[model samples]
Target: MSDPNANRGLAGIVAAESALSFIDGAEGRLSYRGYDIHALARHAGYLEAVYLLWYDALPSAMELAVFEGTLAGQRELPAAVLEVLGRLPDASTPMAALRTAVSVLGQVDPEAEDISHEADLRKAGRLVAQLPTVIASFDRIRRGLEPVAPDPELGHAANFLFMRTGQAPGPTAARALDTSLLLYLEHGLNASTFTARVVASTLADIHSAVTAAVSALKGPLHGGANEKAMEMLLDIGSTEAAASYVDKALAEKRKIMGFGHRVYRTEDPRATHLRRLAEELSVESADTRWFELSRAVERLMLERKGLHCNVDFYCATVYHALDLPVDLFTPLFAMGRTAGWAAHVMEQHMHNRLIRPRAEYTGELDRPWVPIDRR
Candidate 1:
């Protein structure tokens, strides 16, 4: 018999055990392995965080160098993948293009059918290296420009900026981006991560799992929130209009994207760092309007709704200040989250299980079938 007390959307359900990340929702704390997120965000590089997520320990200096070198060596996409991106229509969204490219990568991978741990780790590293290239290539191609080749000398975050802009990022910009990527490296069983883990449980390749994760992330309620938040700011057009727009949105019961979270009763821990990045970048860019407006809306939302900002809220301004288009925001998220997704996939594969779950029946039981002629 099905339990009538089933949790809708699997709320409060512990689907699987993981050693990758821990979230204290009531306390508003997040950690990777046992390292606190704040400490990692402040002190660790993105690649270090990636290593920690994948291996469950921080890498030694020599190990990190080798890891970074291995990842950098894999940055170039398959020529066939680039050709595919070149042929995609200009209007194709970045997420769609990324999904297609990753699937194509699976097709071309030598060990595509290999489910072994070593092969999966290699595939994960390749994906981490190549996804930013895919995103940056698509962005440039769509704008009638050639893709910028990645600089091997730069680290992951800086290399991404260089690929996107064809120039090395300043220390501040690089650090801000590095911090953002580090902050987003992992979280506890987020929607997209769960999707990745679910696909992995089916014994799919890492690429397929990550491809499915990207699809899940394309939804507005997941990875698209930051892009929508940026749109809201742009729609308001000025700081002076922020309150009126927010008030009208509240009165109409429209969702104020980026202002709340499913798990965090207090503030999202990641938001604190992103909010500071937004402020820093805005000041450096000599345009504080977006950050100012974001703060205003945040204050109003809190006063009226008692909601706190999630990671997506201030990230809109930060990315905007970096001159990234709104559409690419989610792809950037996928790039950062690739590490976490791959980690979850690895974890799921290590402890294999089919993820099938029962649905509670709500319809008439054992209904008699009628013949078509009789009916």
Candidate 2:
């Protein structure tokens, strides 16, 4: 029998072993494949980070060039997929559209039924390449604009921005987005990653696993926090309003969207890089209100609640400064995290096991069954 005192939500439970990423919550440290996140965010590009997560090691220069070329080549979507995106209602949320689009991609993929490790890896590369394109295209289509084609010359982050806005991003803006992607690429057995692993363990194909992962991420407690955080900032509107808004929210016991985290006791390490990026982007845009307001809220939250900022808090300001639509924030999160999900899916497949856990039943021990016609 399972212990009655087993942790709720499986908190602190080590269900499976992985070499993909590790989180040291006590020290607020995170690493992917034994490489520190700070080092990757500072020194590596988004593609490089994705390569590391997928291949379990950083690629050499020649290897990286070929890998990047393959991804760029796969960026073009099938016409049928584009048509599906175009037909979706403007009222559709980006995450919902992405989920549907990914499902369609699975249906159309020639190799969707392939379950071999080599085939799964190829699919992973295709997903990493194609997700940004899908997201950028849907954003443009919903705005009644034609989708821009991917530029072969641009790297992943720059290419995404270019596609979304029909103009190439400046170096600073592109780099900021790249760093944010690195920060979001992977975490240790997060809800969506676990979802991916669970699905993969059932011997499902890569597309199915990724689709399941996307569904899990669409939940508010998982990927929707960043969108909520951005909404909160817009609600506050100014530095002067931030403290009192926070005070009122706190007095009413309202949950602050981005202040606390499930794992990190201190500040999220990803937030450290994002906070700086937010400040820098805000400065470059010559509108510092969002960053200043965020800082004021940060101060108040810490003074009263001792809760430090998580990755979502500063990313709201950063995305705002980049001129990204607030609604697309979670889809952007899905784009970055596709790499991690693919990696976990592959890893789970490599070491196959059905992830089945039992619940301690508490509702009825000896209750008599009631008939349908009972009076």
Candidate 3:
């Protein structure tokens, strides 16, 4: 039998270091490149956050505008990739199609084999730019709707919303999404980010690294939390049932998808901002039902379990208020985290080292092999 005390998930293992993001789990503090997440979520656009993560500094006004333009220009998917998306089975999950599309994207990139810093950076930019297109295209194709072309006039988050719904998002909705993207920017060596770094360590192209990361994030324990949280609230249906729902879940020893974090002993800092945003958008749209239910569930969870909600909890209501389908939640998460994954990929390639860890042996020490035709 395997040793029960081994680091089953490599928890607390510091595999490598980079100047990416910091999380003070004990105090519920998070910052990216020395900037607090709260400030970024409130004041920065998603493009700015992407630049900061990749370049390690905030860009100037002209520089940011140039960055945005470059990304916008590259948002249109190649014809081959679009054909592939259309060819996929209609019932394919968004994440499954996204994973395949990203792989196909690598296959089509002329510089897919290049690992130099300059080439990697260009590919990274394309991943950030084209991911929204890939997602929106697959979604529309699966639903029997024509994919919308990228709108250069719109910012990154706003363009994604436009592509999804075929309508330009207003300032409040646009800013709300932009803030959420910044807030989801990155965390230190989470599963998907680590997966990106690991793949990049092999000198894989940025698209390959990003594809691996998306696959890792597709797991229910990771990226699916937000979707499950929304399902929970939707099932609960009202603030009146929130307490009982939580109570029953707790009494039955069911896992509450959004309450606990593997790293944070306190509430997730991102959740604080998302909680406010969820309510703001809810109130702005004159539909506070989801927000109220979220609050009630949050209060009950904290009171009974002494657990704090993570980023996924309030994000459910926030995305729901944005009128996003619950099924797209994880894909949206992959969309946000792709920037971070690319950043990690670049960092790993710059200081490449194969992340080969040892596995503990718990089987019999010297087992004699049986002959194939033993009597």
Candidate 4:
């Protein structure tokens, strides 16, 4: 048998090839479409980065205006999709609801299977355009509230917040949401993006590939960690409680949610930016309760596990302050990640590999058949 440690956790696995983002986990660095994540978070809006992810460069002035116009154009779902949204149970999870809606979208736009570059770009535009609508609609439906109409005057992030809350978000909340979306836009070969590429490699339709990705990303380890981080903080209750919780969790060898990452050994680059957003939102509100709880957990996790929070840690509090539902956190993740997935899909199709990998076999060798009585 091969050495067990030979592939510990599949660490350093080169899952796919792409001209997308590169993550230096050891250095806590991330870049998208060749721009540092810090710069993008500081300056760029979410849709701009999405354009870059798919098109390989930032848009020109006229291109930016045109792209924004296109996104504004497709903000409403067809009546059929809204009907499905109406039937979803109020208790349904957002990822499940989103997965269902994504499949249902195939029925609404039956032409989404067109794979030529021009055709794919059109579908990409539609998906990007409709994502906010789907998310906002699901948000209200699950909360027993009616979905609000989209406002074309608002930017992407502002429109999303406005649609969810029935009022305009302040500049600070809107910017934070925009940065959060940019931060979530891409990472190097994450599970869901890889899943999308795998399906795309098989020559499936883009909708089918994306649908596969949504299913893969539903796992707590992949996209649900942010919601889990919030739950952990509420369960901890206080700074004093945090210490005890850390002690017991460490003694039992249990993972503290949001404490460790598969890629980063020192810190998560995305966490740095999200931490700033959490602090900024706290400053804007002058309420530090959630921030303090998060800090306590961070301190305890580092002291106990020598690990730091990933993007999901402080983001929980940010979303909480925004009054977002816990279940929707991961779907929000998908809304942002769709950009990266689209980019990777284009890359996979252009450079066309089958993506077939061999498993290291360690099973019973071939043997002659025996009668049941002899066995």
Best by lDDT: 1
C-alpha TM-scores of all predictions: 0.97, 0.97, 0.97, 0.95
As for candidate 2, its clashing pairs are none
| Model 2: per-residue Cα lDDT over 203-295, one tens digit each | 988888888888898877888888899999999988888888999999999988888988999989999999999999988889998999989
Tens-place lDDT digits, model 4, residues 1-375: 778678665678887767788888889888987899889888889989988888888999889889999989888898988999889876777788888887788667857666777766777777777888899998888778999999999999899999998999999999888888889888878789889998889876667777888898888898888888888888888777888887887899877778788888888888888888898898789988888888888987887668899988888888877778787788888888877777777777777778888778777888899999999
Residue 149 local lDDT, model 3: 95
Candidate 4, overall lDDT?
0.83
Backbone collisions counted per model = 0, 0, 0, 0
Report, for every candidate in turn, its global Cα lDDT versus the true structure.
Answer: 0.90, 0.90, 0.89, 0.83
| Candidate 2 ranges beyond 4 A from true positions | 1-6
**Superior candidate under TM-score, 1 versus 3:** 3
Model 3 lDDT per residue over 1-375, tens place:
676776779888789898999988998899999999988888888999899998989999999999999999999998989999999987889999999999998999888899999998898898889989988888888888999999999999899999987999988888887888787779989999999988888787898888899999988789899999999999999998888888899999998888899899998999998999998999899999999889998888889989999988888888999999888888888888888888888889988899878777666777788999994
Candidate 2, TM-score vs. the true structure?
Answer: 0.97
Worst 10 residues of 1 by lDDT: 1-10
Clashing pairs in 4: none
